[model samples]
Target: MTSLVTDTRVVFSRELRPVLRDPFTVIFSMIQPLFFLGLFAPLLPDSPDGGSPLQWFVPGIIVMSCLFGSSMTGSNLLYEMQTGSHERMLVTPLRRPALLIGRALKEIVPMIAQAALIVAVCIPFGFELHLAGALLGLVILAGFCIGLGALSYTLALASKNKEWMFWTVQQTLLFPLLLLAGVLLPIENGPGWLQALSRINPMTYVVDAERALFNGEVLARGTLEGLVAAVLVGLLGLAAGVRAMRRSD
Candidate 1:
């Protein structure tokens, strides 16, 4: 147990250091969320409680950030592949799963920072924060990112630095996942088929949980579903990521 933790920390540290040095890209990633907040949000109807759109939209945007950012992390591994850095690491004594876990762990910090910045940006625009709920919401967001990040690394390994393959799978899935989850728009009023699709999409659950958490509905059914979905994703990602790591190892 101790060794696994240590290994995870080492891997996490290695994954984190580069972003700590140059965070410009991290900030750049925020522009899209802000754009959605500024532009797309106004086109929506008010919250049921007569609140600003931020009440409903902010949490969704946070999840959106987690989704896109974690998914793109595979490209980093692809870069390591091209330079043979990844090959050299494979020669080290690190545990295989730790390699993947550590990289996935690195996703948390930047995501939290971006979430904080987004909240700060939204506050001046009349977005209210539900402290306890927001914190829990972040927990949900982190779980989703860790799982997704691991799968992304697995994809990177599978692609063998073939940028086209990696991007193809990512682009094909992300927008569909994003839209189906109704992050920027409500699917409640959509066609029966669309709403049915949303029901099966786990991201729809997670997004609902974020909004529920943000609204301080701690005991909401969506919250339970979201947590389950995150755990399932993490487990699936770990299984696949570990297999990919072993193959590469």
Candidate 2:
């Protein structure tokens, strides 16, 4: 038990330090969502549902951060592949799953912090939160990050040139998530078929659950259905990523 904890901590520390040291890493991860909240929030039409645009948009912004950070996990895998770090680890006694878990653990803290900040900034813009749901929302968001990060890590292994191809392929992975999730607009406003499609989208589940939770809805009733779907998809994505990585090796 002690060794497991120590191993996770060491890997977590290693993963986190580089992210903290790089200024661009932090800025680029955060800048787009902040820009969306600042510029686009006001442009959204007011709700007859009796809430501000900030209420709806803030959850989406939080989701956007998850979207970006989760995608960036590929970059870490790319670095490992380029530097032969992954190969070195392959020779180590450390459990492979532990390495991935530690990597996911490290990535999630920053994502959660960014999500909290989005909520804080949105307060003036009229975002509300039920304490219980906010807490659960954070968990759901972190779970999404972990699943996506794992997937990205696996994808990076298949990428022949991780650096050059990382950004290009990441855009492809991210756009579908953002569009189907209704980050910038409501899914209901779309066509009936589109709305049905959005329901199955895991990202949309988080966005909808969090948005409802942000409106101070009860944690149990408002979120249970969506949360279940999010958890399932997240687990499936992570499992697929792990399988891909082992196959690549």
Candidate 3:
């Protein structure tokens, strides 16, 4: 058991080092979301019934960071696959599941850092909230991102396609969730059907919860729901990825 944990940590450290080394990725990951928040959040129509676009969009921008992280999940594995490193690793006595889990876990660092920067940028724009809740929101969003990234990695491995599919699917699936999460528009203000759909979207729960946190609205319910959804997504993604790897072996 200790060995498994150690292996997971080793793999996580190996994956995290590259992120730290890549100054460009770090710069863009942390700054781009803030840039979006400043430029696009204001252009959104003023909301009388709902909160400002900054309020609505901040959570989605945070989620957007996660979505982008998901695109890279497969890239590393694909590169290793092409270079024969992945095949060699498969022959080791180390637990393969730990390797995958560790890789996914390490990605949360940058993902959360990116989200934190977005939250920090939001403060100047009048987006305020309890520090405790904001911290909780960041943790929750990071978990969701980690899970989603794992799922995307599994998909990439399964698809065995080019790099474009990773970006394409990440954008296609995650962007719409952000849109529905009341990012550009108020989920409550939408049509009944659309509101219902948003309610079903896991991303919506995170947005709703964060919005409440920002406005000092109680958001225990949304937070719980979002947490559950993120956990499920992560578990399913990890399971699939492990299964695919097993098949390859």
Candidate 4:
């Protein structure tokens, strides 16, 4: 057990070094969320419930940041695969599960940092959140990130061509999930079919939970549902990712 933990940490450090060296990648990842926060949030009409626009919008932006950032992780894996870096790692003494765990765990660091930055920026704009709620939201986001990052890596490993993975992620998966999650606008106000579809999306629960948390409603039904969804996603993603790694071996 100790060896597995140590190997996972070592693999995590190896994957994280390149990201640390290229700080711009982190900045670039945050830009889209910032754009929505700065430009789009202001244009939103006042909430019917009397909350500030930032309060209503910031949670969605945080979820957006997590989704976009983590879902794109597969592209990095594709690069490693093409360059033979992933294959080289396979020759090491590292366990297959550790390879996926380490990479997936590393995703939590940047995601948490990004979530913190988003909240800080929104604070000056009148976003209100309890520290306890904020911490809970971060925990939820961590689970979501681990799951999405693992799934991304698994998809990358399954694809024979990098372009296929890129196309599928961007064109097929990302936008549909984003739209269904109601990141840009509330689905409740949409037509009946759209609302129905949103109900089935796991991300819908997550975004709703985030909004409840941001409003300091820690015990809200949405918050509980989101936590459950996040755990399920994390388990399923880790399972699939580990299976993919074993197949590669």
Candidate 5:
């Protein structure tokens, strides 16, 4: 068990080095969320209670950051594959599952950091967050990112050398999930079919939970539901990613 943990750490360190060096990548990832905060957030009508629209919008932006950042993790794996580095690493002493776990875990660091940045930026815009609830929300977001990152890596493995297909599949998967989660607007106010679809989307639960958490509703049903959905996604993604890695071996 110790060895597995150690190996995973080593792999994670290796994967994270490049990200640390390329600070611009992290900045670029935040642009979309910041854009929403800057442009779209002002258009939202003030609540009857006089709360800023930022209170409602920030949670969705955090989740959107997770969605976009985590989903693009595969691009790194795809690069390694094209350069033959992934195959080279497979021949090393590292356990097969550790490789995927390491890469997936690395995604969580940038995700949480970006989330923190988003929260910090929103504070001036009147976004309110409870300390304890923010901590729990971060945990939920981490789980979701780990799972999504694993799935992204798994998709990369499946796509192999086909760069075009990998991107196509990623776009096909990301936009619908984003739209269905209603990050840009409330699905409840949309068409009936859209509302129905949002009900089934796990991301919707995540976003709802985040909003509740931001409002300090720590014990809300949405919080529990979102945590469960995020855990399930993590487990499923880890399983699939591990299986895919082992197959590559």
Candidate 6:
């Protein structure tokens, strides 16, 4: 058990070094989300819950950051595989699961930093900051990011040869997942089919939880649902990631 922790820490720091050197890599990733906040946000009517659009939109953007930031982590692993760097690591004595877990864990720091930056940017524009609830919300986002990151690594391993396959599936699924989760626009009044799909989309629960927490409603029912969904995703991702790591070339 101690060895796993040590191995994971070693791997985590190795993956994180490049990001530390090039901080803007994280900031550049936020460009799209910020654009959505700047342009798309003002077009929406105030939320029915009596909150301003920024209040409603900012939380979703945070989730969007977590989604995009964590999901693309697979590309890094794929590049490493192509360059033989991944094989070098495979020859090390580190436990297989540690590789996946550490890579996934590395996503959390940037995810939280990006979330904080978004909140700071939005607050000046009248986005309310519910400190306690927002802190809790970050916890949920971190868990979700870890799970998503692991799954991304798994996908990269599965597509080590055909890099396009990773991008193809990612591009195909992300928008549907984003739209269906009501990140940019609410789907409450959308068609029955859309609503049905949203109901089953796990990310939808996380979005709902983010909104509720940002509103200072930490005890809201959506919080429980999102926590559950995030945990399940994390467990499933780690499980799959470890399995994939064990089988990697």
Please report the candidate that would top TM-score against the real structure. 6
- lDDT of all predictions: 0.87, 0.75, 0.70, 0.86, 0.88, 0.92
In model 1, where is the ten-residue run with the lowest total lDDT?
24-33
Candidate 6 lDDT (Cα, 0 to 1):
0.92
Residue ranges of candidate 3 with Cα displaced over 4 Å: 29-32, 45-53, 161-164, 215-219
lDDT, candidate 3, equals 0.70
Q: 24-87, model 3: which lDDT tens digit per residue?
A: 5755544555666767777887567665666666776777667666645677887777678877
Each candidate structure's TM-score, on Cα atoms with residue i matched to residue i, is 0.95, 0.88, 0.85, 0.94, 0.95, 0.97
Query: How far in Å is the alpha carbon of 9 misplaced in model 2?
Result: 3.4
In lDDT terms, which candidate is top? 6
Q: Could you tell me the lDDT of residue 37 within candidate 5?
A: 83
Per-residue lDDT of candidate 6, residues 118-221 (tens digit): 98988887898989999899889888999999999999999989999999998898889899999988899899999999999889999999999988999999
lDDT of 1 by residue, 1-249 (tens): 458779888889998988898877787656777788778877888878788888888889998888888888988998998899888988988888898899988888888998998899889978888999989988988888888998999999999947799999998998888899999888988999999998888889899999999888999999999988887887788888889998993
Q: Where in model 4 is the C-alpha error above 4 Å?
A: none
After TM-score superposition, the amount by which residue 135's alpha carbon in candidate 1 deviates from its true location, in angstroms, is 0.5
Name the candidate, 2 or 3, with the larger lDDT value: 2
The 10 consecutive residues of candidate 5 with the worst lDDT sum are 23-32
lDDT of 2 by residue, 32-149 (tens): 8898888988788877876677777887888898888777877877878778887788677766666776776776878877877778887876777667777778777777788778
